[model samples]
Target chain A: MKAFEFLDEIGTVNTHTMVLDKGLGYAYVEDALKITGEYFDLLKYGWGTSILYDTEIIKAKNELYHSYDIKTYTGGTLFELANKQNKLGEYFEELDNLGFDAVEVSDGSTVIDPDIRENAIKQAKENGFYTLSEIGKKNPEKDHAYTTEQRIELINKDISNGSDMVIIEGRESGKNIGIYDEKGNVKTDEMTQIHENTPNEKVLWEAPQKNQQVELILKLGNNVNLGNINSNEIISLETLRRGLRGDTLGKIQK
Target chain B: MKAFEFLDEIGTVNTHTMVLDKGLGYAYVEDALKITGEYFDLLKYGWGTSILYDTEIIKAKNELYHSYDIKTYTGGTLFELANKQNKLGEYFEELDNLGFDAVEVSDGSTVIDPDIRENAIKQAKENGFYTLSEIGKKNPEKDHAYTTEQRIELINKDISNGSDMVIIEGRESGKNIGIYDEKGNVKTDEMTQIHENTPNEKVLWEAPQKNQQVELILKLGNNVNLGNINSNEIISLETLRRGLRGDTLGKIQK
Candidate 1:
């Protein structure tokens, strides 16, 4: 039961918010998780941050995330970096040693051939990790060049290649990339087309902004998988989904 | 000298930023302070959040803040809540007991007559706390009614009423209040007028957004006092002030 249980009477609200832990210490994560762990499902050590932190801290953080049934993964950028350096085997070993249950395979910052991107997804699966493959380039122009049809093609290919989830890249900014416009507003037509082509549960949208989250929730229902969520917004996003926030108050049926 | 000396060829820079703590535990504060304590001066537990946490936690947090030479204070809304309940005396005593060395007095949410607001400022001064009074209303329309000149008048009056600092209310949103417009852009004309009218150091602008911080730093110089900064942005903001960010890079210099 929530603090505003009366408002969300139908009571079916499970917000799958994946928080970005950008270089936070284990004790800090523990203290923070005490207040907000129940609101999230996945803990992503953003970008190459896990590679930057001590191995012990990363392992400890993974254990903490798993304690709350939160799947832990290194950011796609790290996997992409490792793949670029031909260290994918080493990366898999390091990730497994660090106790990460999942890994994000992305070519957001680097170019991996479509064939290679798909093969990497299968390789990650063979390595015994739940894989989330991301589509779209980090650079806005390159990302926008992909037609909605092309995006659907990549999404289908990744899923076929055994990706557990496909992330529509929002790249922390959620602007001028994929479905989001320059002002960070969602292009509704693109969103609908993508949703029609992809399974909603297997697709996570990186929505770092509140308006995007509100719009996505109202469009796709509360269980919409959201990623790149700042640590501060975990509770607020949950409230927004549960109709406790003023923005989504009367709109979401409990 | 700061920890990352390679980034600071000009030795180190001075910055006075007031970060919003909201409701952080002692351990979180200790860890965060260790990371960015050299960057900021004061910590504000934003808007009645201390009421949600225990007094011992608040006291310990205050001690941690003080150890880092960061003065700590309860948000103006908390003080207003006590004042509304006519327990202002007890509120001051409680703040002192909790080791708060500063107090913020504002009428952003509630209506307080000029005399009462001024008296609160004077009382905070008499109680030996560094005072930070605020201008502008929390509601957009109400805040808009205060003309630039009127805001300048209030700022001057607050300083005269014994405030150590007078903050232009941005309500953690930094939009459509005081010198900021609805899009969170600074109204330069009004900002210039306010600067012309008030004694500079007595005014601290609440700039919660990075763009706002960059704009203020560019226009007002690196030493310009800023408030209501989110805890996560402390290092990022410090970098911006020193021209390390692309936005403020090569724009401001000693």
Candidate 2:
């Protein structure tokens, strides 16, 4: 049982939290999960970092995350790399062998033909994986070129192509990307535009910063799907969601 | 043995690294220590977070750190709180019982009489604790009020009062405090003034950002003592010290 149960703030229900696991050791994940296990919905091996560690470790980490009922996936970079190498089939096979239940299909670092991107999402879904398609360029200049209308179209397109969820690219820094301004403050107009157009429940916003998390949660209700969270901030984010933290305290409506 | 031994980069030697632990669990520490334990010299329970967790957990963490030959201590805020409550003696006794081998003496959040500050350091040393004193206010405006000369005087004074090391406060943000500018850039003029005036070896710089770490490593050589390192960045910081990362690669001199 959690402390301060008398306060009776509604804890995480119908909200999805995806944490980024960037090369954390086995015992570390085990301990962190013991405290914040129920809070996480997804575990991402961030941005090609999975390739740096032994295959055994990745498989073990996948099993650990699975124990908490958290779906595991490699970052979009790995998928993009596989696509570039003409190894999409091999990539899916490798993911299956490694115990990943989800796949992120993105063209953040490299260009993918629109049809190919759609097919990847379809293929992932057909292969019994939860397909999450991302919409944004890794380069800030490239990312800024896409108008809100274009982003909305892509998000809709990806969902239509059988993506279980469409992720907005916030990157690790969460600065000057997608709907965030240079200082990481949410551009409310752009965020609202995207939210209004997209299926809000199917759209997961990659909010890495604390301020961004608070803003997104406050603006879109507690059930906002948030991703790319730092592993250490799992419990902190759960507190924010439950309105147990000062930022959202007494502000979250039941 | 560490990977990439053929590269033959000189690893950390005669340098101190102090990592912040803000309520991490036992197994987490054990796993992190197994990989990057040798890099750490001091483990600080950041701010007043220690009081928030169970005393048993704190004792276990302290023992775990000690096993890795890393000295553990509560943050200066706790010391400041003790000073405020006139429980300095009790604080020392509690630290002993908690198995902390070190203590940080600071007036960051509260005012301390210079005589009392000196006595606190002496008391900690007398109680067989490695005494660390921090300089700079927690408030940015108040911290900015101190001139370079005043900082030098305080640093020298703390050492004279038997401080094992004096930490130049950058806080966790590493911005607009001590020698860091608003953009978290190093104010080289102020940094040089303090370094030239004081015994550089006795001063540990709190640099929490990657840029700050790179700048400090390049400017002061790899042996410049750094504190307030996030637990996840331990391996990354060690790589910077060894000229393994792109930022400091081919830039660090023998």
Candidate 3:
């Protein structure tokens, strides 16, 4: 039992918490996962880091996460790089070799025509892997170039193209990207519009900040899937989702 | 040469950046150290995390850190607990068994009388560990009870009692503790007073937040030693120290 169990509330909220593994060593991954495996479900080897790791270590970490019933995948930037380089074929081959249960395709760092992005999603489906494709850009100026209408259209296209889930790009920093502002605060108008436009069940909001997570939980309900979660914030995020934290306490529903 | 050399005025900054390694496995430590070992001098097994790992894994991580010439130590909270539980001797034996060349003694989470706290420092020195002791309580109410004079006395007492370094507690959150306020901003008056009263070279201020780090660096110069740095922030912190980042760019002497 927790030390302050008297302050707890009753609930069983199945939260799909995704941790950002930005180039962790297999040993670090093993040790951290041992303590937190039961608390988190998905792990994204953050943005192009998998490309930098040895194939043996990548393979080993995949096996380790899988043993704990955790699904592992590459960051969307890796997928975007693969597509931008016309190396999607090679990417899938490597993903299979790496034992990844899933792969993330994104246009976060590149400009992919909507039709081209859709085709990439369909191809990922044909490869027999769970597909999570993201919609946004990395640079703040170019990211601001995207309208809510454009983002909604892209989300629909990816879903129709067979994406299992669509991730909103928050990047690692989470600020000045997509729905977040320069101060890392959510632009609620666009956020609500995107939520209304998409099937919320298939959407994963990349909330890397506590306030963002709290706001998303308050607005979207307890079971909302959140991504770009730091490795340390796994349990904390779960607590927020379950109203175990001060920010969301007594406000979130069971 | 750094990519943005023209943006900086390089000097003998001699910065000490310490990163936390809370229960990281051997291979993971090796892999992470490959990317970040250049940026840190000390590695802390965060708050009682040393007790969670196998003795063998702890030894291996210590050896791995040593290969990079990074000294390894446990968090101050662990030392406090050991002292509180009357297992201080056992803790030192375990530290030796784990091959840690350094250790921290802090009363962050628990209370130790000034005499006992100083004795702990002397005992750690006699045991051949490079000791760093921390001031300030973990609980906010208890911490606020400490006057600046008391803090100064504690700093001098620790150094005189054989501590290699003295740390002002910033806790992992870096908020409402030590010199930081509720918004994680540094209380400038208290901070400057501490520096004025204590030997700055013998002190490592726990500035976990970016703004707190910027404040301390701006106040104490770029060569100022900081602790409790997250593993990911090593490169970013280095950039700040060298005037490479937008925040500290052109402001730092180095």
Among these predictions, the greatest lDDT belongs to: 2
lDDT of 1 by residue, A1-254 (tens): 22211111334366567888888777777887765666788888889878788777788889988999999998888998888899999998989999999999999999898888888889899999988989899998888789999999889889988999999999888888888999999999999999998888899999999889989999989889999998877756765675544356446775
lDDT of 3 by residue, B1-254 (tens): 54545643665467677786544446556777777788889888776555544455567778889999898897765576567568788788878877999989876665578788878888999999989888888768989999988999989988989899888888777998889998899999999999998888889888888898888888888888898887778878887887878988878763
Lowest lDDT 10-residue stretch of candidate 1 chain B: B7-16
**Model 2 chain A: ten consecutive residues of lowest lDDT:** A1-10
TM-score of 3: 0.59
Cα lDDT of model 3 by residue, A96-201, tens digit: 9999989888877787787877777887789988888888888889989889999999898788889988999898888989999998999999999999989988
- Going through the candidates in order, their DockQ values are 0.08, 0.08, 0.06
List the candidates ranked by TM-score, beginning with the highest: 1, 2, 3
CA-lDDT, candidates in order? 0.81, 0.86, 0.80
Q: State residue B203's C-alpha deviation in candidate 1, in Å.
A: 4.5
TM-score of each: 0.63, 0.62, 0.59
Query: For candidate 2 chain B, which ten residues in a row score worst on lDDT?
Result: B48-57
Instruction: Tell me the deviation in Å of residue A17 in model 2.
Output: 3.2
* Inter-residue clash pairs, candidate 2: none
Tens-digit per-residue lDDT, B153-199, candidate 1: 88998888889988888877787778888899999998888877888
CAPRI level of candidate 1: incorrect
**Per-residue CA lDDT of candidate 2, range B62-178, in tens?**
888999899988778667756766778878888887788999999887778999999999999999999999999977888999999999999999999899999999987898899
